[model samples]
Target: MAGGGVAGHGASAGETKLPPLTPGPYRRRLGFVALVATFGGLLFGYDTSVINGAGGFMARPDQLDLSPLGLGVAASALVYAAVIGAFTGGRISDAWGRKRTIAVLAVMFIIGVAVVSIAPSLAVVVVGRVVLGLAVGAAAVVVPVFLAELAPYEIRGSLAGRNEMMIVTGQLVAIIMNAIIGNVWGDQYPWVWRIMFALAAIPAILLLLGVSRMPESPRWLADKGRDDEALEILESMRPPGRAKPELDDIIHTREIEKQRVSEDIGKIFHNKNLVRIILVGCGIGFFQQTTGINSILYYGSDVLEEAGFGTGGALIANIAPAAISVITALIALQMMDRVSRRKTFLVGYALVAFSHVLIGTADVVLPDGGAAKPYVLLILIVFFVGSMQLFLNIATWVTLSEIFPQKIRAFGMGLAVAVLWMTNGFLTLFFPTIIAAIGISGSFFAFAALNVIAFFFFLKNVPETKGHTLEELEEHVTDGSIFHSIGRK
Candidate 1:
C-alpha cells in the first residue's frame, strides 16, 4: 500500500470527516482517459520502429542517396531536436498546463509526420524529423508526469506505465507493417517507406480529438491554488475518502517547494538533496540509451544483415525482438509495483550485459555467411530487448516522473529526459559507424562493458520509488532519506 501520514488522515479542527473510498463508474472513466493519453506513446513507438525499415529504404540509390554518415545524420536529427524539445516542453507544461502542452504536441506530430512522408530530399527529411522530434521529446517529458499526477499511488505504476505499453504496441504495429511491406512491395515500390512514415499521423489526429475531453492534472490544479477544481478531479479519479487526503498532500508539498524556491534550476544545485536526485534521474536517462537498444530498433535489419541474413530475411527476423518487447513490457506492468525499482534495474543491467557478451562471442566465433549466425544473433537481441522493456524502460520513466518535488517536477523531469534524448541522439548518429568500424563482436562487447558499469551505477544511486505517494516521495528526496535504502523488497 501507499505510505501513511498522508494529509487529511486526521481531520483538521474545522474539517469534516470524509467517507471511505469506493469504486464507481469513474474508474472506467479514468482508464479511458489514460488510454486516450497513451496514443502519444503509440506514436513514439511507431516513430521508433518505422525508422528501422524506412531508413534502409530512404538510403537507397534512387531515393535520398545518403552516405553512411548522412544516414546517421538524417536518422538522429529528430533525436537531437528532441533534446531541445524535452527541456522546453517541460517548461511549457509548467507554464501552460500538461493538457494544453499535449494538445499542441499532437498538432506538431501530424505536421511533422506529414512533412517526412513527402520529403523529396534528405534536407527536407531531416527538417520533417526535427519537427516530429520536438513532439516526441515533449511527450516523453509530459505524458508520464500527467498520468502520475492523476493516478492513485497504489495503482500509479500500472496506469502511468500504460505509455510504455503503448510504445511497445506501436513498435509491434511498425514491425508487422515493415515486414509486410518490405516483403511484398520493397522491390517494386519506390514510395513504401513514405507510407510507413505517414501512418504516425493517424494517432496524432486521435490524440488531438481525445485530449480535449480529458481532465487536467489535478495536482497541477492544486499547485495553482484551485482547490475546488483539484478536489473535484481527485474525487472523480481516486477513491472517495482518498481524494481529499491526496489533495492535502499535494497542497502541503507545494508549500514546501515554495519555501525552497524549488522551480529554479540553479536553486536545485544549491540544495544538495535535489542535486542528488537530479543526478540519479539523469544517470538513468543516460544509461538507458548507452545500452544500445536504439541501435537495434533503428537498425535491426542492418544488424541482422551483418549477422549473415539476406535483406528480406533480416526484416522479418527483426519482428522477433519487437514482439518480445511487447510481451515483456506487459509482464513489466505487473512487476512495476511488485518488484523493487533498484532490484529490477540491477537485474536488467545484468541481463543486458550477459546478452551483449554472448552476442559478441558468437559473432567472433561464427564464420562469415554462416547459416546459424543470424539465428543465434536474433535470439540474443531478443533477450536484450526483453530485459530492457521489463526492467529499464518503463521503470526509468516512472521514477523520473515521481522523484522530484511538486514545484520543480516538470523542469526536473525535463532536464533528466533531455540528457536521455541527447545521449540517444549521439548513439543513433554513430551506431552504423560503430558497427562498421568495430564489427558486431566488438560493438556488442563494448556495450557489454558499459552495462557492467551501469550495474554499479544502479546499485549506488537509484532510489525505491514504489508504494509511496508523490508527496511522500518528495519528502524522502528533500530530506535525503531515500538514499539510505536500496528498497530491498
Candidate 2:
C-alpha cells in the first residue's frame, strides 16, 4: 500500500505514528464528482423542506381541508415510505451496484415530484410523497457511502460531508422559493403549493443526466473481483503513482474477509465486532432525531405559529434556521478535517441541550401574545438549529458511512438509517399532537433532557474515523480496538 504522511518531529521518540495523508492530487475531479452525486442530497433536502412551507397551504379549506390527524398523516407519508426505501435501497445497491441504483433513484425522484405537483386530491399527493420518499431514503443511504469510498482518507470527512451540506442547501432553496411563491401568488391562486413541489424536478433531471457520466465506486469494483477495472478507476482519481498499491491493498483485504465470513446481512449479528458497529450506527441515528431537530425542520412554521407568529410572519421567520443551517454546514465542512469527531459531537450536544432548556424556560416565563415572546422564541430556535448544524447533522452522516466494513456496508447502513427514518416518521406523525398536548415549553424541555442522555452515549461508544482511509479504518473496527479511542489507529 502507498505510505501515509510522516509523523511530526514534535512527537515523542517512543511513540509510533504513521504520517497523515495530504489531500492534493485529483482535487478538481473529485470535487466535480462529489458535486454531481450530492444532487441526490439536494433533492433530498428540497423534497423534505418543501413540506415545511407547503403543508399549511395544502391543509387550507380551499385545498385539502385536512384535519390535524389528516395533516399528520399527509406530512408523515413520505417519511414512512422512506423507512422501506432505506432498507430496500441498501440491498439494491449491493446487488445492482451503486451508480446504476442512484440513476434509478433519480428517475424515481422526477416521477414522484411530478405526481405531487399535479395531484387533484390529498390521496394522490400522499401517493406521490410515498414515491418521493423512496428516492430520498435511497439517496440518504447511498450518496454518503459512494462519496466515502471515492474520497481519499485525508479529505474523506469533507467530501462525504458534502451530501449533508447539499441537503441543507436544498432546504434553504425550498424555504426561499416558498416565500417567493407565497408572496407572488397569495390566496388568489390555489395552485401555488403545486409550484413549490414541481420546482424539485429540475434538479432531479440534472442528477439523472450527470450521474450517467460519472465513474462507479472503485471499492465496489474491487470487491466484485474486477481488480483491473477498479485499478483503472482508482488511477484516474488517486494521486500519481498510488493506484496500484491501493488496488493491491483492497484486493488483499477482500481476500482476508472472504476467508472469515460469508457476505450476509444475518452475519452482522453473529459477530461481536460487527454487532458493536451496527449498534453505534443505530445509536447515533436515533439520538440525532430524538434531539427534536426535525421537529423544527419538518414543522418549524408550526412551532413559530404556536409561539405566536401569524402564518405569514412564521413563514418568513422560518427561513432564518434554514439560512443558519447552510452557513453552519459549510463551517462544519471546513472544520471537519481539523477537529476530532467526538469533540465536535460533544460540543454540539451541550449547545443543543442548553438551547432546549432556555427555549422551554422562556416559553414558560414570557407572557403569550406579547410582541417580545415570538421573537425571543425564534432567536432560541435559531441557536438550537445552528448548534445542530455545526456539529451533529453532517458529523453523524459521515461517521455512519465510515464505521461499517465494506462487506456489510450497504446492509448495515441500511439497517441504521431504517431506524433513523422510522424514528423521524414517528415524530413527524405526532409532533402537532405533541405540541397541542404539551405546548412548545414542555416539548423542548423533553428534547433537552434527551440530548443530555445523547451526550453520554456518544462519549462512551462512538469511534474516531477522521484521518484514515476506509480500508485502514476497517482493520481497527473488525478487531474491536477502535471503540472509545481518540483519533488513534
**Which candidate number has the best lDDT?**
2
Predictions in order: lDDT: 0.86, 0.87
Give the alpha carbon lDDT tens digit for every residue of 293-407 in model 2.
Answer: 8889989989999999998888899999999999999999998888989899999999999999999999999999999999999999999999999999999999999998889
Q: Quote model 2's TM-score.
A: 0.95
Cα lDDT tens digits, model 1, 141-164, are 999999999987777888899899
Off by over 4 Å in 1: 1-4, 8-22, 487-489
User: Each model's TM-score, in the order given?
Assistant: 0.96, 0.95
Worst 10 residues of 2 by lDDT: 1-10
